[model samples]
Target: MPRGYGGTKGVRRPGVALALHFAFADLWHDRKLSVLGVILLAALLAPPVVLHTLQVGLVETWARDLAADLRNREVVIVGEHQVDADLLAALRAWPETGFAVPEPSFFVTTQTARLVGGRGSSVPLDMRTTSPGDPVLARADLPPPGQAGLILSARAAAELKADPGSEISILLQRTPTGGAVERREVILPVAGILPEAHWPGRTGFVSEGALLGFGDYLTFSSDTPDYRAPEDDERWQSLRIYAPEVSQAPALRDRLQNAGFETRLMTDQVDRILRLETGLRQLFGLVLSLSALAFVATTILIQWLSVLRKRRDFALMAVLGMSRRETATFPLVQGATMTAIAAALALGLAAAMGGSVEAMAQGYLAQPTEIVRPNLIPLLAGALGAVALGGLAGAVAVVRLGRLDVSRALRGD
Candidate 1:
């Protein structure tokens, strides 16, 4: 043995070694209670751990959906006055601009003929008419300019009971200025039906030439006997400006607005969704904080009661020349050991359950999703936090231990 190692004087110094020995002895003496403390701590920590993991999954899914929506949308600017072809050309020349197409969508009413055992129905339609160079139709595989046909959204097709190569009659209503409303019918061939995956709305597309034949070029048509040649409505009311990427949407929207048009960008919708996610996370965090406080209070009460019950034993230690400071170290060791073991078990449980919860969440979402586990960092933080809270209880016990009288304690006072 080394020179001073074998003596009680060497091993029982009033420092770490002596403190740890006393703490360990107390724990071994009441090992069942220590184990119970561990189990209780694990239960207390589980809620926040599980909630945090689920929050990650929710945020991830929302982000993916928002990004996809933004990527698929183009920044649109609607002007109070008509947007001229000159303005369209200027916008198309702008940096990061891909397509600057006039949006000639107007509200139209139509009635469908029942086909394939489907019932006839009257439906309101937002009809979009565009020129040759528009990029939107290119993504849908619509044939170039000369081919005249109507493209219907899945919902529109279902309501109309219409399909490609089927002919349908559209009732066009043109309310002339200071005259009775004029109604006309045009039979247009259905070109194709857009899959629901591509568009999630009831809409249809038509050629600008087809709409012009209905005298749709004028905002208001004339039916008076003394007829004036209708001025061409060559003015586009809105421009669908496509950006090179979704990231450029906000800046492009600003640029369009500065140049005198009201703009709506997909980024605005994405920002709102992000703000909502932040609020939800904050709410969950607040709940977790409350849960943590309850856990700490429970630990404090348990430790404080244990300390009071062991007063006689601590007094006996004091009678044997052990200092009050040495006696106080018992709770620190107990709290740390119990909380560490509990945190480890809780983390493992949370991780195991997190994967299953994420899979279920993904199944519910429109897109695939996976949650990010809080992992070792949060587990370590929880363990340390619990130890710190227990240490406060330990400090209270220490004060009581310091004030203890050996004689009174032995007499069961």
Candidate 2:
């Protein structure tokens, strides 16, 4: 008998502490069984951890890559329409709207431009209106509003042999109603160069104010001495609308369509990505649920069997004056300790498996990005759940311990 089991009041140990000591000793005495239980539990836990880590990492990485594509979140007006400031304001007020800029007619927006100091034929560049928060220019330096500055796309810059700080001459030609053709050349400094991934075609991005001014110049006679830009109430021919997130693009597109606006969006791609993510989550949830159930069942069965085998030992402890509460706590403490160790082992195994998968993806699959990274929150949560479930399982065994016939068990009946 342990010294603390039936000790005098002066030397008596705490009930829980004494039970913990006996639990550890009992586990050590049956070290092989304890080790086997830990191995079995770890084996059950590791696969789900690895699967969840990979699934979350891969899906998150894919979603991030898709979301980074500005085109996926853009809703382009199909053709020329009389878009107005009020409409633009209304669209901007929508929670789903990330950015909305009115555009001039496509006929007036395309202009022949050439570098002022370079020797290259003039190239017809499609000018797009941009504002401060334009997603297309997210990585490019935006020109100041109302300034004669241009941000040229990679193709436009290449064709003009121009870079940032270079000056480009935009030749604006328009035939006024029942009048001869009018031509005007405007030289603007290149503020920045957009990456090819942002705008691939031969395009130039100018401030909305600048585009409006150019449209006004082309629409009216250039000979007017007091050339004033169009008023804010002036209607536009098109609009460039963007959603803050790709998931919102479909809804925004539907809203525009419902309002009699024809727009184009990558809704099919967005829907596919969304569906994939949802399906993966559901599948992973089912797998995790089954795994957890199996773990609980195994823990309860194994711990109950262990308690049944040690019935006489608990009976002997009761005979030695140990309280029933203390005796019942033995299996609970042992189960918690074993499960804690198993959780650690499972985490280690998951890390190893995840590393192997990541290595394979990097080396042979040609995926350089991390695709099996484990999130700390989920890992900690899983570990805590395992320990809690293990305690619950042990509690079930403790219920059986309460039913033990002390005298009969001690008599080896």
- Assess each prediction's global lDDT (C-alpha) against the native: 0.66, 0.81
Off by over 4 Å in 1: 1-15, 68-102, 106-234, 239-276, 375-379
Clashing pairs in 2: none
Candidate 2 wrong stretches, greater than 4 Å: 1-9, 13-36, 65-69, 120-124, 132-141, 145-147, 171-185, 195-201, 209-228, 231-233, 266-268, 278-294, 316-323, 353-375, 410-412
lDDT of 2 by residue, 307-365 (tens): 99999999988887788899878999878888899999988877767666666545533
Give one digit per residue, the lDDT tens place, for model 1 in 235-336.
655655777655566667778888877878744655555666677689778878987887787777766777788889877877777777777787767666
RMSD of 2: 5.0
Model 1's TM-score against the true structure = 0.56
Root-mean-square deviation per candidate: 8.8, 5.0
Model 2 TM-score is 0.77
Clashing pairs in 1: none
Best by lDDT: 2
